[model samples]
Target: MESRSRRRSRSRNRERPYEITISTADMSSKMQTFIMEQVIECLNNRSHPKKMCRYIRERCNARYGPSWDCFVAREYYGSFAYVPRHLLGFELNGLNFLIFKGA
Candidate 1:
């Protein structure tokens, strides 16, 4: 059986056209679900903090394509006066911890 890494490498050149129409409600729910599941999976499966951060950041980039920075800024940066303290590994509560515990 081929490994996940091999599968990903094999698709490096596949240019998929962007044609999916997502409503605002659907996009919001889908992004939230995708983020939560990926974050949980990375936290549970990864053994290092940096690795987990990279995993999530990469997932965001892949999911949003060229607009990842815009999404991150809107979802995480622009709304806050400063970078969230939890992103620096402070003790946080509930889903906040799950979202921001890593680097």
Candidate 2:
């Protein structure tokens, strides 16, 4: 028999679909193109993950305004196929340690 608290916790842990609201205006073609290009450049140049994040943030801020979040850039970086899953979590000296996995 499960404890009442445990049952409640289990219910809470159940995954549920949720809607995320994002402004369509923020996702313009130009913005998408810029993010894609930046992500590809970072991968090709073998940039540190933190550096890539900073670069994207800076560029976005310059093009947009300070009101814009860096989420778009981060999403692009996270989806880059060339980067390994494990490498994403490892950071040293405020920068990601570059590690290439077998292709």
Candidate 3:
């Protein structure tokens, strides 16, 4: 089988546009763990989702390019289930508070 880099190069030279699909399952265990760690740190800091997204983009761009969306989405959804219900609402500082408790 051809290596991924070789396949990419071949596709680039072809006239047809090639679509590459990479799922979380395709990532290495180390990469998945690293991404999860970053997500946990951001959530623990109570950073807004938008800010978290930006941070993810900046941190992951070099390695994952524009494909970091899946990581962010997975983390956000996981957070919803893990975060306390009281902290799961409202938008503040342009950050959607996934957990907000009403007084």
Candidate 4:
């Protein structure tokens, strides 16, 4: 019985991927607006996405050591013009995009 409860608690605390939430009460207030603008500017003018991915991988390494599968792929094969659907955790096939969570 104790082991079963422990297993239930562990399952309850599972990590969620890509969880982004903003808690500010006023999304349109001046300060909030300014911050949002800054974020957009950074996203728009940031360095080449490929280079940025490498930079991100390096930083993540410093904090979490290294991961073999962490990577970035483009929307098209051997191209970097846009982020790939696969990178967003989706599978693509004839006019269909499937997204699922994996354990």
Candidate 5:
């Protein structure tokens, strides 16, 4: 059974709007908007960063290709090597979203 506080917490999350800002994107603008939607929806359902990353990767892979990789974190750095026109970095609800396909 779920506690009342837990349920309320989830309800609050679902009610909040997620704002997305593109930090750096090598991909298309259409892809950026699509990813923003995916990220927001995933965030509504999942509370963990790893789960969010996997969710975004799976979505991208289904629509684009299987090489899709996603990193969801509050802070990220240290060299990202990805294919041309297949990398996007953004901020969604305060977390850094980095999606790319390996070269």
Candidate 6:
């Protein structure tokens, strides 16, 4: 299997494009794209990681039923318990993000 995470440009002169390297995921392609969009949106909004996690979680629950949650950090190491096929892990910029829907 091939991971199609685009070759991100190393230019800091302009805004970084929406690109992520997904490490582990069990979500649909559509939802995966949505996560990317949310990350970019939150980053552009200059939101703090905690606030960003809450915003993303709320947005996700609003769109995809409920029980959504998110965590963002530079070096993330934690346990997770979530609904099947509703978990995603990826890296954006230098942050590690894990978002999931719990029972």
lDDT of 4 by residue, 1-103 (tens): 0011110111122332212123212112343233223223323455454553455445434543444122333342332222221122211111111111111
- Which window of ten consecutive residues has the lowest lDDT sum in model 1? 1-10
Model 1 global lDDT (CA atoms, 0 to 1): 0.34
lDDT winner:
6
Off by over 4 Å in 6: 1-15
- Angstrom error at residue 63, model 2: 0.9
Each candidate's number of clashing pairs is 0, 0, 6, 0, 0, 0
Query: Model 3, poorest ten-residue lDDT window?
Result: 1-10
Using alpha carbons, what is the TM-score of model 4? 0.29
Q: After superposition, how far is residue 40 of candidate 6 from its true place, in Å?
A: 0.5
Candidate 2's C-alpha runs over 4 A off are 1-26, 68-103
Tens-digit lDDT track for model 3 on 1-103? 1113211111223354322222223334455345444545565567766777677556655554443332233224443222121121222223322221122
Residues 29-58 of candidate 1: C-alpha lDDT, one tens digit per residue: 456456545544644453355565567667
Question: By TM-score, how accurate is candidate 1?
Answer: 0.40
| lDDT of all predictions | 0.34, 0.37, 0.37, 0.27, 0.73, 0.79
lDDT of 4: 0.27
TM-score for all models, in order of appearance: 0.40, 0.41, 0.40, 0.29, 0.78, 0.82
Error of 1 at 28 (Å): 0.5
Give candidate 4's error at residue 98 in angstroms: 15
> 82 in model 3: Cα distance from truth in Å?
27
Q: Once superposed on the true structure, which residue ranges of model 4 sit more than 4 Å away at CA?
A: 1-45, 73-103
What TM-score would you give candidate 6 relative to the actual structure?
0.82
Ranking by lDDT: 6, 5, 3, 2, 1, 4
Cα lDDT tens digits for candidate 6, 1-103: 2233543422233466656787878888899778777777788778899998999998898899989989899996877688988988888888888899996
